[model samples]
Target chain A: LAKTTQPISMDSYEGQEVNITCSHNNIATNDYITWYQQFPSQGPRFIIQGYKTKVTNEVASLFIPADRKSSTLSLPRVSLSDTAVYYCLVLFSGTYKYIFGTGTRLKVLA
Target chain B: GAGVSQSPSNKVTEKGKDVELRCDPISGHTALYWYRQRLGQGLEFLIYFQGNSAPDKSGLPSDRFSAERTGESVSTLTIQRTQQEDSAVYLCASSQGQGLYEQYFGPGTRLTVT
Candidate 1:
């Protein structure tokens, strides 16, 4: 089952910071939260992942609280090319099935 | 160093005909997965394979859908008596490990059933 839920869509302007939050209330202790960014006609690309605290990469950052009930993906600066669907996935250690909830459509406007 | 690869980037078939899709996961990656995404919809998990263990087919919509993984590399998803509803983009992914690791996805195969 899909354990995460995110907003249907969001809009942002160029050079703005966009934060997309995902809620996985029943997340298991062993589960890890990962995020992927998908562009038109292409596969989803791994952006960032985190178990707790925060993880920052060249492209994005992932922040998770101690409770792990929810997580946020932060994109520092937005551009027109950054417009795509962002998916939040709950990855279970035992089950290889990556449950992807309906992702948030991010539109970066100029 | 190659990522996951899938065959026949696009396919169009008659409603009653059968079709086969192939996926070649990253070398030495222990896990492979299949997912279907329709237009304007989230990905729907189809199946998963890890190592030599049995595959998890719970996500498959019907018995006509079956997949097989050879060793820890190549995998194939076959659909018999395809229906128009089966039209969607089939995506393949693999991870070095499950859970704690992130999955790398391949360019999906667009299937159009008529």
Candidate 2:
């Protein structure tokens, strides 16, 4: 099982870049790292996914080093709307199961 | 196309009562998942169903919780003798396939046990 850990909370001002890192010391070789953002009273929404290196989508970017033991989610020029709980999940390909972390609460102040 | 949807946006039940929650996945989705989220907590995997395979109940908290799915279309999660600890948001998600695909989530059903 690939258990992930992230910071409990973070605060960032509007228009600033925010980076949330997750540690997964036991990540498997075929495990894929994915990120999800959730707002109050709503289900989580997918943000980005990556196996290694970096993957940038319209909403966010995911960075993973060679060891694949950790990854970082980068949100550029965050706004108030970006305030939500972000979770780092490890997708086990063999079992097709997802293990979610406690998540990082990001508060973007305007 | 419509996304994943759950019924009875909110449900409140008394202790020791039985409650059932429903989930409707996307049209062609082959994988469905159930999860629970407590107040200010991350999602907890409950169960998973893929096509006609046996539903994965490894994540279920106890025998009081059971789920069933019919032909990958709809799924129902039943909690028997509900307790205060079962009070949380029950979420449903579906994906095109079980692999490394993106999961679309529903609004979720808030289950309140009093």
Candidate 3:
């Protein structure tokens, strides 16, 4: 598993776009970048995932550079409910082992 | 299409007692995993099971911690002689075939050992 580094916390305002970036300098060729959102007292929820380039879903978008060393999760029109801890995970395809690092805590204020 | 479910949502046990944490993975999911989350901390990988193969117990913290899965259905993590340090939320997740697939998680069992 590749070690990931992210900011401890970030603050955003309502209706504004928020981007959380993660750095995985030792990322492997087979690794995929995935992001998860965790709310208080609930399990982490899958947000978006991408191997390279850009992937967009109804909820969020994932932008991965060609080098794959880093990726960013972009949330459009943030709301107060969007406040949560975001975890960036670098996992190998077809493996069950996932190492979760201290994620970036996002706070969307009104 | 129920998600992963864990039992006892909360478990309060005394030191030296054994406790069991259960996990019911999603139907047809071939991979199941166990993780621990300490208060105000990150998730810690505990174990992984795929179908009927032997589970990967390398992440088990100590000899006192063990987990078992029956077929591809349910799994139980047994903590022997629980201690105060064992207090944390035990999480369970399941994926389709593994290898970077998205995993669905349960609400998790909050274990408090006093």
Candidate 4:
């Protein structure tokens, strides 16, 4: 079973910064939080990943608290093209049992 | 365009028919994975293959679903007697020997069982 949970849907404006939070209270020490973005009719794309602290990439930023109970994905200057499903996955690298939780659908309005 | 690729972008078949989906992972990726996605849902893990190690088939929903990958290369997912519930997008991904590497996904095969 997937151990992560996030909002079902969210809405944002084109130029606004969007923040989506995921809760994984039972996250393990070896687990890493990875986020993926999927557009309609396309496979999911890698966004950002972090274990603790923060990790930023060209696409998005992943912020994980010290407790690792939750993490947030921040997108800056969102656009209509950014509207898609965002998945938060908790992966145990040792066991490799990667499960994708139901994603947060972000609809960007112009 | 060095990325994963799957065959038969769209396949429509009658119930009880068998279907084979193929996946070609990135050139040097040693870890390949298969997943299923229903409409407006997250991916469901199907199988995983790493190098020459035995595939982890723990996620296969039923015995009718089976996948094979040869020497960390092209992989094939074969479903016997496909059911209507099998109608979904089959996605394939690959990473460079796993371990904290992000998986790269393919366009996926949309299977519709009529």
Candidate 5:
């Protein structure tokens, strides 16, 4: 599995855009970049996923550079309820396992 | 319209006891997964099942942990001789299939062993 590195925590206020980046230098050609949001005492929810370039959904957007070695999750007009831990995972090829790193904790302040 | 569901939302057991955690995936979902989240720690991959085929048990922490899925609907994770270290939330998720699908997770079963 590809190892990912991200910030431990981040702070933001409501109505501001929050961007979290993840680095996966050993990403494989068949690997996909996926992001999950986890609130306290709940399971991680899927936010966005992308193989390359950009993919936008109703909730968030994922931007992957041409190199596919890194990706960014962009959330617009954040609110206090958006405070949660964001995980960037690299799904292994032909396997059921996805390696999750420490993840970036986004604290949305009022 | 129902999402994934897990039974025994919270379980308290003694050491050396056995516990079973159940997961009901969304209807039509073919891929199911099991993960463990210890306090102050990241999610740990446990196992994955696709349809009725053999599950990938490589991620299981020890021989004491095991899981079984019936058809493509329900799964049960069994822990034998549970230890204090087994205290954590066990999460279950299901996806449409491989490549680019978003996984839907259940609320999970919080197990505490004393």
Candidate 6:
């Protein structure tokens, strides 16, 4: 399993774009980076995923550096509802096992 | 279509007792996983089952923790001789397949061991 490192917490104002980055220096060639959003007392929901370069979805965008050692998750125009724990995971394509790190707790302030 | 469903949303048990948490994965999904999350902490992988292949039990914390899945349908995680540290939310997720596919999670079961 590839170990991931991310910020412990972050704060952002409403309507401002927030970006949380994760570093996985030992990422394998077959690994893929994925992010998940979790609310209090509920299970996590998938946000976006990427292998290389960048991938954008309706809810968020993922940008991976050329080395694939680090990736960033960008949430555009943050809202109070977007305040939740964001997890950056490196999925091992061989076994498909996910090793989740202590995620970044994002707080959107008004 | 119903998403993954876990029964006994909340379980309160005493130490040294045994408890079972159930999970019903989405129809047609071939991969199932169990995770434990303590308050204000990240999720900890528990066990994984894929099709009829032998489960990967490397993540199980102790010998007292075990899980079983029938075919590709329901799965049950059993905790024997639970301890106070066993208190946490038990989450279940399933995907069409393991590799590169997004997992759909169900509302976790909050287990409080007294």
Give the Å error, residue B95, model 2.
0.4
Two-way lDDT contest, 2 vs 5, winner: 2
The residue ranges of model 4 lying beyond 4 angstroms of the native Cα positions read: A93-95
lDDT (tens digit, per residue) of candidate 3 on B1-114: 588999999999999999999999999999999999999887888988888889878789999999999999999999999999999999999999776679999999999999
lDDT against the true structure, each candidate: 0.90, 0.93, 0.90, 0.91, 0.90, 0.92
**Candidate 1 lDDT, A31-54, residue by residue in tens:** 889899999899999898888999
Clashing pairs in 6: none
Q: Per-prediction count of colliding residue pairs?
A: 0, 0, 3, 0, 0, 0
lDDT score for residue A14 of model 6: 100
DockQ score for candidate 2: 0.85
Writing each residue's lDDT as its tens digit, candidate 4 over B1-114 gives 389999999999999999999999999999999999997788988989999999889889999999999997999999999999999999999999765789999999999999
The DockQ score of candidate 6 comes to 0.84
Residue B9, candidate 6: alpha-carbon lDDT? 100
Query: What level of docking quality does candidate 1 show?
Result: medium
After superposition, the stretches of candidate 3 with alpha carbons farther than 4 Å from their true spots are A92-96
How far does residue B61 in candidate 5 sit from its true spot (Å)?
0.3
Residues B35-96 of candidate 2 have per-residue lDDT tens digits of: 99998889998888889999878789999999999997999999999999999999999999
Shift of residue B107 alpha carbon in model 2, Å:
0.6
For candidate 6, write residues A1-110 as lDDT tens digits. Answer: 45788999999999999999999887889888889999999999999999999999998999999999999999999999999999987776555568876799999999
Give interface RMSD, per candidate. 1.1, 0.9, 1.1, 0.9, 1.1, 0.9
Model 4's interface RMSD: 0.9
Worst 10 residues of 5 chain A by lDDT: A93-102
**What does the lDDT read for residue B58 in candidate 3?**
76
Residue B99 in model 6: shift from native, Å? 1.7
- List, residue by residue over A1-110, the lDDT tens digit for candidate 2: 65789999999999999999999888889899999999999999999999999999999999999999999999999999999999998876666668898899999998
Which lDDT value does model 6 have at A9? 99
Residue pairs with backbone overlap in model 3: A93-B99, A94-B99, A95-B99
Give the range where candidate 4 chain B is weakest over 10 consecutive residues by summed lDDT.
Answer: B94-103
